[model samples]
Target: MSISIIRLGIDFGLVVLIWMIQLIVYPSFLHYTTTNLAGWHRKYTPLIGYIVGPLMLGQLGIAIYQVSTDFTFYHSLSILIIAAIWIITFLQFVPIHNNISKGRVSESMLMSLVRKNWSRTILWTLIFLSSAVQFF
Candidate 1:
């Protein structure tokens, strides 16, 4: 019923959307292109990647800001979790993708990045859910 509660709900929804994109939509999109469109790798999909990747990062910002701006008496846990996730995203995920964008990396590198970064994803998912509890 309050602003913080609304923000938390929106944040949770966006976080779930992100997980769906990463785990479902992206892989399916790539897989479909690999089969349905020959030469997708040469230009088309990479261009889409350039756009979609940044969009995902933007969504992350949305979630982070939503969580950060919501103030509650016990907000420290939410703040700490969002801050940690943001740091991990900057420190761990960004560099690997930077390499990819520069042609200095490979899919294997990104997969490696994801594997290493899985904990952050799970942690943030938990953070989103836990933050939602403040509404109750």
Candidate 2:
């Protein structure tokens, strides 16, 4: 398959995974007890990272590669959007998750995490659709 096809597949997969995490898995965190919350979150972070981290890196790298080669307005715009997602992930989400993993399970923080995560979820959805339009 072509490189664009691969990028689209990766983008679509990440979109689906993030939606699931946002809608289902994260909401479930509210139910865990404080004692188990840390352990649960600790275990959960790495496990989910195992799946998501590579896909994210792949998407970012491919976006950069595409823009580097083509440098079209749309491709560069896509890269900017993808970079924003990475920035949101590292700057906002990771620190939030780190707090949670340390047993700091405030309802406000949990709510913030869920709310902020929508940035990634929505951006990934947009990215996938944009890529589909570009590719198909």
Candidate 3:
């Protein structure tokens, strides 16, 4: 009903969608048999790249800008957590994704990678939730 509730709902929805893609769709598509992998990959990669990725980045940018202007406890903490998550994702997650694509990946490796990067995902989600509170 309120603006804060609407923003919270949107933020939660975005995070949930991303999590579903990373945790379910990606692994399913990767482990799919036949032409399913290619089909799903072609369909989803563009959506993630062109739409979801940019929107998430824009939200992060806004968070950063807001942090710069605010400089309070929660704002600083949220920015740091978000930045850490982004940095870890690019440095750690991307390599794992590349390895899997190159046929050099194992299930254990993928699982381990996900486990290691879980903190990043969790932290980013927290940052999103905390920042969304500012909308209220």
Candidate 4:
């Protein structure tokens, strides 16, 4: 019921989701042929967006609320990190995914996805850990 608890839950969800994406989902793109990967990416992006969109919005919204209400160090840090994630997602990842959807699949691009995702994996994990610390 507490805001901290809700924030922790959202952060935990992101941590798990990003790990799955980094370790399993993105890497699996390498196994697909170009045409198949493009076709699958078209479907996959929208479906995955359903799951990712809400969680990310929830996380960002809660972070903003927390900082605006309390203005503590932890809340500020969380909001900053969330902002970074959003920026990276839109500025970097979105274009790549858009290209992939348009049949621009390449081994280098797939590998870059896996490589670039480590930044998010670490950031989400850090957010979760910080949330856990605040919760406990």
> Best candidate per lDDT, number?
4
The global C-alpha lDDT for each of the candidates, from Candidate 1 onward, is 0.57, 0.89, 0.63, 0.93
Put the candidates in TM-score order, highest first. Answer: 4, 2, 3, 1
Worst 10 residues of 3 by lDDT: 33-42
Per-residue lDDT tens digits for candidate 2, residues 73-100, read 8788899899899888889988888988
TM-score of 3: 0.72
What is the clash tally of candidate 2? 0
lDDT of 2 at 90: 87
Model 3 C-alpha RMSD vs. true structure (Å) is 3.7
Q: Which of the predicted structures, 2 or 3, would earn the higher TM-score when compared with the native?
A: 2
lDDT of 1 at 17: 55
2 or 3, which is superior by lDDT?
Answer: 2
RMSD of each: 5.6, 0.9, 3.7, 0.6
lDDT digits (tens) for residues 1-136 of candidate 4? 9988988898899999999999999999999999999999999999999999999999999999999999999989989999999999999999999999999878998899999999899999999999998746
Q: How would you encode candidate 1's per-residue C-alpha lDDT over 33-123 as one tens digit per residue?
A: 3334234333544675575455445545655565567645445555566667668767986676555444554446545754665666587
Give the worst 10-residue stretch by lDDT in candidate 2.
Answer: 104-113
lDDT of 4: 0.93
- Decide which is better by TM-score, 2 or 4: 4
Question: Better model by TM-score, 1 or 2?
Answer: 2
Clashes of each: 0, 0, 0, 0
